[model samples]
Target: MKMNMFGLFNKKKSDTVSLPYTTDIHSHIIPGIDDGSPDVEHSVALVKQMQEWGVKRIITTPHVTEETFENTPETITAAYNLLKEALGEDAPEIIFSAEYRMDENFLKHVKNDILIPLPGNHILIENSFLQPFWDLKGLIYQLQLKGFNPILAHPERYAYYYDEKEIYTDIYNSGCMFQLNWLSLAGYYGKETRNIAYWLIEKGYVDFLGTDLHNRRHARAITEFLQTKEYRKLVEKLNLKNDTLK
Candidate 1:
């Protein structure tokens, strides 16, 4: 397996490695709901490829942004059902969830008690790419107050927080868990994100590692990344909670 400058992989299907854990907590596999898989065929293909890489269970998280995705429970479940019907019994166990952007829609869902959580009542939340949300600490408090365990999604991708590394510690200290995008360590997002990922690992702040699998391009990068010496070294020292999801 080989990786290119664009972070895509050139490899055969046989060039695979077992994932560190079976359950992928962050992925966008629900068909047509977001920017992940465009249709059921694509969703099936991604899942099959993931199974080949030894992911036995997947908690597929589609985007739930206000203006962009606007994924309600009804829409998400509909897409999930369609994908499951297409896959039949020849795939990994898949659970439907949402990677919620901390926006008004999310707050509304929280108030209405309409959010879908992971197996352990864990909710994956994302911040805006351009800036951290104005009241992230308040939002985390609200989620916790409502009995939801919040897991911040892909902190390394937030460029605004890069210079203020102490804020990462503050969020973790606020009782919110952190989930690092595994591909970030593979330089899939770029050198800066990869550096932040390693920094989070060194800080003992990353509680989970997720694929955040969007499409085939991401899958290829991750598959090739899993076979690298860097991946082996990183996993050896870090204590990840991915397997505990089941």
Candidate 2:
């Protein structure tokens, strides 16, 4: 269980810094459930890496898309239990929820009240990348009516809303909180996504910061970015709610 021997943690203590927030609200570390870790071994490695990076608790959110992941509570729980068993006492505190796509399937879950939420009843949701969801505001209102706090996951990655930036404000005003992907700030997606990430920070629209980590490549990029001056500055400017989730 010597997690420090893995990844960037092997660097000199002065050369590396722990994440500001102890609770990581978004990640894909659950094994074999979605596009995250492929199995229990990979999940253990990823969790150990996060532990070295100062993550005390992980709220691993697997994708619950309609046609793609189609994850159910039973499936997610089984995978989560497997991961926990593999890690034993060496693992960081782990909880399981799902990143729900805003679609008919999710609406059905809402109707059935089967959706898993983060601490404080906050639910992470995403929009279709190909196009904006119609009546997204209404959907947010519906979630709110059902007593769930809906947080739009990685708003910067949605290219359709780039030109119509006013929609961002509209969505915020409609009471949907925004979660910014930490990798987006590292320019992992591209220049446009980085720009929007900063833009959200400047406008004070970003309420939560998530790793959105999918693999080892993402872990390396995020680890490198964490030590940069830009990352330091960005965190100072952000009023993130990640700690509140604990």
Tens digit per residue, CA lDDT, model 2, 1-246: 653324533454455568878899899999998999897877887887787678899998999998999999999999999999988987788998899998989889999999999999999999999987888989899989989899999999999889999999999988999999889999999999999989988989999988898888888888889889987887789788898984
lDDT of candidates 1 onward, in order: 0.88, 0.88
Each model's total of backbone clashes: 0, 0
Which 10-residue span in candidate 1 carries the lowest summed lDDT? 2-11
TM-score of decoy 2 = 0.94
Clashing pairs in 2: none
lDDT of 1: 0.88
Those runs of model 2 whose alpha carbons end farther than 4 Å from true positions after fitting are 1-14
Error (Å) of candidate 2 at residue 55 is: 0.9
Instruction: Give the Cα-based TM-score of candidate 1 against the true structure.
Output: 0.94
Off by over 4 Å in 1: 1-14
